[model samples]
Target: MSEEKNESTKDTKNKDKSSDSKKPSRRRSVGIVLLGVLLAAILIPLGVFVVAYATYDVPEPEEVTSKQVSSIYASDAETELARIVPPEGNRRQVELEEVPEHVQNAVLAAEDREFWTNIGFSVTGFGRAVVGQLTGDGSAGGGSTITQQYVKNSLVGDDYSYVRKARELVYSVKMTNEWSKEDILAAYLNTVYLGRNAYGIEAASHAYFDKPVSELTVEEGALLAAIIQLPSQLDPWNDPVGAETRWNYVLDGMVEMGELSAEEREGMVFPETRDPAEYSAYTEATGTNGMIKNNVIAELGEVGITEEDMTTRGLQITTTIDTKTQEATLDSVEAELAGLQEDARAAVVSIEPGTGAVRSYFGGDDATGWDYANAGLQTGSTFKIFGLAAALQQGIPLSAMYDSSPVSLPGDIVVNNWDNSDSGYTTIAEALKRSYNTSFIRLQDDLYNTTQDTADMAHALGVARSLPGVPATLTENGGQPYEGIILGQYQSRAIDMSTALATVANGGVWHETHFVERVETSDGEVLYEHEVGEGERRVSELVAANLLSAMEPIAGYSSSALAEGRTSAAKTGTAQLGDTGQNKDAWMIGATPQLSTAVWVGTADNTSAIFNEWGGNMFGSNAPSAIWKSTLDGALEGQEVLEFDSPGQINFGSAPNQLYYDPVPAYTPPAYTTPAEAEPTEEEASEPEPVEEEPAPAPEVVVPEVPTPDEPEGGGIEIAPGLVIPDFLTG
Candidate 1:
């Protein structure tokens, strides 16, 4: 029994020892499997990356590499005005040596401060991007080195997919190993789009500063670098404030990177930019329409934009200029100026009331010559409106009486009418309608202790900028006021005159004139939009309505009116070339409720007097009025005919036509006649008179009668001292 027990125990021990030995085999097998899995994890990705790196042939981006053009358009963006590009298609490759060192540093500071030392990619940036792609949070992209940007934009595409992102990473590494840092930078600089329709640093420098890359200042270079992060969004012309803020960030980064000093960053200012229109080879359009470009450039400058930050950003610029209206204006000017002397020049400006948009503009036939539309010319009785407005503001009604006969000034200067005509006494309404020089001169003086009232009124009516030479304390530009301002002796531009008249038509509101309506990027994202706001109210509604009523008959309805339903008011003026007895400048400014148009005719050289086809002096009522009529007739043909907004009837105070002279029967207009038709045809023909003809007669007054109870029931106007009443009316 003892022997059997010993044997059983030994057998159990042997079985246990055998089982322990088999466990080692299982452990070895587990270790082998783990090692194999680790090897696969590392080698599979390595093999896949190698394949992608070798297979990915970095092709230069055809879309960015190709030449593209930016365009300028009329108010309707579809009507392309000009293609904005230099002869070289707005892109010109330049060697890195041509670029200033500071400019290059600025680019580095803006894009990648570690560009010089880093290996073409940011480990953290790439990791974040991958994380964003995997998590679908969209917060991963955008941290790229300069080489990576080039690889993404110029080599691999900027696709949102993970595959593309992976490809970009591989290409960045390959480029760093194969291409020198300088080569990568050159390629990137040559391919990048800076604002203003420019491609490459060379073209960008020229488009922004009108200079070569070599001439770029540190500040300018910094701007170029700053915009690279988001070209269209940070365009200097479209969003100047945003662009400026981003530019400061670039400078700050430069300071942090030791490339620029903190003090230098603080002191740096945004550089002035150039007009992209001037850079376009196609922009040399010498037609009258070309003035639109000039005005657009000027209007943008007024708002602190050097050129195209809000106007052009490799973007579409839609101006306020109406294409059809502009075309019609040119035609009207040419037709009216035809048959006149060779030295004759003409300008026309039309503005939309309440909006301050210049609809039609003609500077002259020559686009590069003197801008007659913008440059000031001697304004004649067209300035009488300002005096009348001034007097009205003083609580003086149009019925106030003034001496219309010749008067002596303090300088012993004798003031006389063109035809040596005298009324003895006439109302302010009659004086303005007839353009009576002596009456306005006295009116200017009687309104204020000083003669500056007329000048102040003129400035208030939106003519100050154009009439800079007129001296008044109201305008910071200093000068003394004379009686000449009341009679339109001071110079004024057609644009300013049009604006003033438009203000009256707009119910006393003064909108600042502007050209660009809006701006948009190539992809149609609106970069800038113009808002027509409630303009500054410079004149009261009563003043504007009364002034319009006084001026109503100056431009007759027969020859010209805004369409048929539109009521119009106008003034005619002619300025003499000293005592030469020839008129040097002639003007006819008119307005409808919706539009105001100013027409001016003068000698091209400004040295000669304007003459008619028959050698007669060209008067404002003839040429300038004809141009005004023709322009309105065509421009307003298909448009809505708006009626004038009446501010009720102007005051008809109890003042006599004359102080001493008895009232005569009113001159009844022919039943079917307008003020223009009431004049004799012989006068309208303008047959040449002798060189000694008295300075052309001022326009006759078309009176508006106001019934009074002071025993003046007879229908009449003011009479001369010895004039006899006609038997037909006085019977």
Candidate 2:
């Protein structure tokens, strides 16, 4: 009985220990269950919040719904120079059916393999993209579906930020729901950027292959699809190797997508592309087309048409460029300068004197992107016509005489004839015909208004009254009209000079120069039409006639004349490069009764001299003159040779007192000798006695004392009252 009781107590103790172990295990299980419940409570709501945040209300796509196209036309209003289509609404949009099945498949295979079945956002793609952003690897991965990419590119923009990504996600879902798959695909194809400034597939097709989209082969379509990755980098013209590699990749992708078979891919080779020059009008901003485009844009701005209006409102511009004249001018310059040095450049501008219409122009090389016709350069002796006009306006006749010898003026300024070849005295007409520098300097000084009046005359005639590249302080004196003003020392533009000379040909009527004759909308509504014959009377008809008479001999039968039988008046100019001892610029400006033209030849660098090995040193009378002659002859081939009207009679005052005289040879008479015979008259002794009574006082004469210029403190010559010779001239 005692052994049985001890065994029972041990069994009870074992049960007690087992029960205690069960208590802790039960508690652990309960704690795990509660923890799981708490996690679910937090995570479910957070996931909902994320989804709600990314999928909230999205704005409608309004920008791509409407679009327009702009066109530029020549003077005839029939020839199209250029068509401007921006990257957004201005691009050419086509329907989904219009895109070839293979082309659509290529884009789908390259961009999104599961575009047809996948949701707007893929879970795997999103996770990978998040990882990429966190790892700081830009090219790591992208989570955007076709719809998501469209939203990012068109709506929220491709900003690498969490907020923009969330917005893109939201818009993508909304866009997928709101727009059909076909609509989304069409929008993407139309809005995407391709190479060579192309905005759409059709434009890209034309840009790369010079063909329409419907004409593209399967290989061409694949090439365009590859460019979607990076358009500028994969341009076929600029990067053929990269473009071909990407094209092959796209072709392989098409094979994997079942759109193209392996056999088809194997047979296809990278197609050859047209040269970029073939599509230069679309790719470049430097050519004849570029000039028209740029000028059209500028004119649109002048009339308060915004650039947005130009691209989106579908404007059609009509220019005043006569195609025949423009071609002739360009050909003449290129032909005349065919053998010129590599850096040499030339420009020409022609205008209708009556209408102020810019008929023709050549602005350096077509690819230089510089409009030298509108650019400023030293005018040289071409500016002398303005001074001559000033003199003529003040009743100074062509017969006014000036001593052509070198003379000293106020402030000790010295003027000399060209090559120091002294002509004793010359009339105004003779001085102008020979380009006598001394005569013009003296004439400017003798004028009542001096250089100030000469500048005014230039302004009236149509030259820009201000000198380019001059300081404000110096330009204050009517464009710094110092003694050099008479010699064309100021900067002037070819267009301005041509227009000014045209004023003389137009009988003193100064018309504002312009290039656009009219502008119209695509619907044929005239937005602007330039009025003709609007000009101000800058000079009397008499003064204009007198000026023409003086200039006639310049284009008469001389070697420098533009045409032998053509009634023309012209002046030649050559300016020295700053201290380089080389002639840098050469010019020839002339006018018929109908057209006025100006030509300039020089180095584009503005530093190098225009030296010719075969022709010796180039001058205004040679190359530029020849170019003008050729251009005018071609431009006015069938036009009538209008006669310049004769000038009305005007009486100039009597000849002024001679300010200078040549020194006569000194006379030394033979030494006085005693007279051989003396014959005394009775009146000689009587007259001597009467003269001794009173000596009449000699008439008093006043001679103004001229002050000599003091030696320059710093090694410069003070040429005028406050003007100093620039360092370039001192050398």
Candidate 3:
């Protein structure tokens, strides 16, 4: 019995051992696998970091060396037109020793106080900033050191993304190791923008005070340091009020840093800055060409190339400006304005049809001055072309007649023709040749019905500016018939005017205006290439054609017509100077099949009227028109003459005069269209039976939120899809 029990116990123990062996340590195996995975994950990234750090070679601050040397060529790409002058201004490299200790301290206090002691970056400073923010100490600045800024300015010209941040960090650390702290500070001083078109402390000092940096007082140094925060706006010339406030901040920082005594800081005041325009480093580039350089820099920015990259990469920029055209435009402006007032301003801009290439530009004599060519001035009758296009789109025809009497409105305002002449019941073609303002105003009410229709049509046809409000700016998405806009009360630039006319000449296609033709590196690598874009259609081909026809007769009727055999359509405009009955703005907008030009002559202030030596306000057909003809002729001197595409054979008599809530037909049948002297039909010969004329069907009244003297008129309200209130003004 004892032997049997012992054998059973031994059998049970053997069974238990077999069960344990079958499990095969599964949990322990999983633990080992997970541990291996964790180690691999850590080791792989660590290995990558080690290899990348060891292999990474810091690039030289090539842009610093190359930024000053760049060339901008003309459309021919051979003739040098200008150089790359950064919009922030010009740089003059200087050694750190030249910068005063107080200036250095001010910069350190403003940007990075620990610039001398800290590594390339300060993680703890950032941590403290984060903690400080949580504790409501919001004034704590960022953690980027001077070396990191140098990396951003010279090495990594990219976005503030994680990858860019990582590159910046890596480059900063490498820069710290390779370059001394003094060198870093010197690089930052030479590269930093201090406004007034000044790029370095030397340039900035000269720009602000017309003095060298060695003579800068502590207050002046602090002011320069303060300007580094927002060089564009925090300048004495641009934002005097804000500039003083920022100067105070920098001075306080200097006091905190122990660089400035309390008594010294208390006595320091914002220094007076020189006239930015006169002190500009770009003043040497005077006249239209400097603006050309400024524009090219902007164009480069548009193509993802930085100013630093442009110089560092040794890029060659070719602009679309035609040399002959530009020269002729400048000469023409000089000749025509010889007898005019000295303060009179003139601007001319020409564009190629379909391509949107700018051929010639004339802004002002001072390049750093206001860009009159790009500035918005109230357009006059040259704006009528848009009204005509809009009317055509709304089903009005070129042959449609309008009441040419003076127009009266609820605001006691009256739209009158030149000399207030009333050419009653005139044909559209005749009204346009005469530039009858009342006819267009009535067309807005009785024909198109709203200002939005004309404004929309204007926008569609190349008006790059926002209208009363809703019309798409060709520059934006890139509108209407506001009567005021139809008559040229809204503002548009010469470039914008040419763009609209070019759209018409391009069979109603709108191309956004551009400057740069292409960009190439010193090594002949293509950095950027300008390709002609498929344009947005602003108006239908037929509507565009009809609008052209309406303008054709007007140009021929004027003495300011394009050069003979130019075969063009044009409109002249003269804007009234308030209630003075004299003109403030004169504009000539003309377009041929291949080119379009807008020439404007006005006073710089726009308040002073442009009167002729003959003692009258100048008209568009005078100097403005003559300039346009000269510009077009000179621009197309070698080019062959091209005729406009045939106008659409559309004769849809006039606007839908019957389609209104209370319709009073606006179309007047021509007197020549009376019944011919042919034999009458039998039904006509017989006595006609009396028939009742049925009332036309009632059309839906849009009755949009019309502008009164009380409420605001337009802000892009949608009454229905594709239907908006008048974008400019309301009746």
How displaced is residue 392 in candidate 3, in Å?
1.0
Q: Which parts of model 1 are misplaced by more than 4 Å?
A: 1-70, 86-88, 91-281, 304-312, 466-477, 557-565, 647-731
State the lDDT of candidate 1 residue by residue for 112-218, as single tens digits.
87887888788777678668767977766656888888877666778767677677778888878777788788778876878666778987887788877998888
TM-score-wise, the better of 2 and 3 is 2
Query: Each prediction's Cα lDDT score?
Result: 0.67, 0.68, 0.68
TM-score of each: 0.57, 0.63, 0.56
TM-score of 1: 0.57
Q: Which candidate wins on lDDT?
A: 3
Which ten residues in a row are the worst by lDDT in model 3?
Answer: 708-717
In candidate 2, clashing pairs total 0
True-structure Cα RMSD, model 3: 20.0
Q: State in Å the error of residue 327, model 1.
A: 1.9
Q: Sort the candidates on lDDT, descending order.
A: 3, 2, 1
Give per-residue lDDT, candidate 2, residue 224. 87
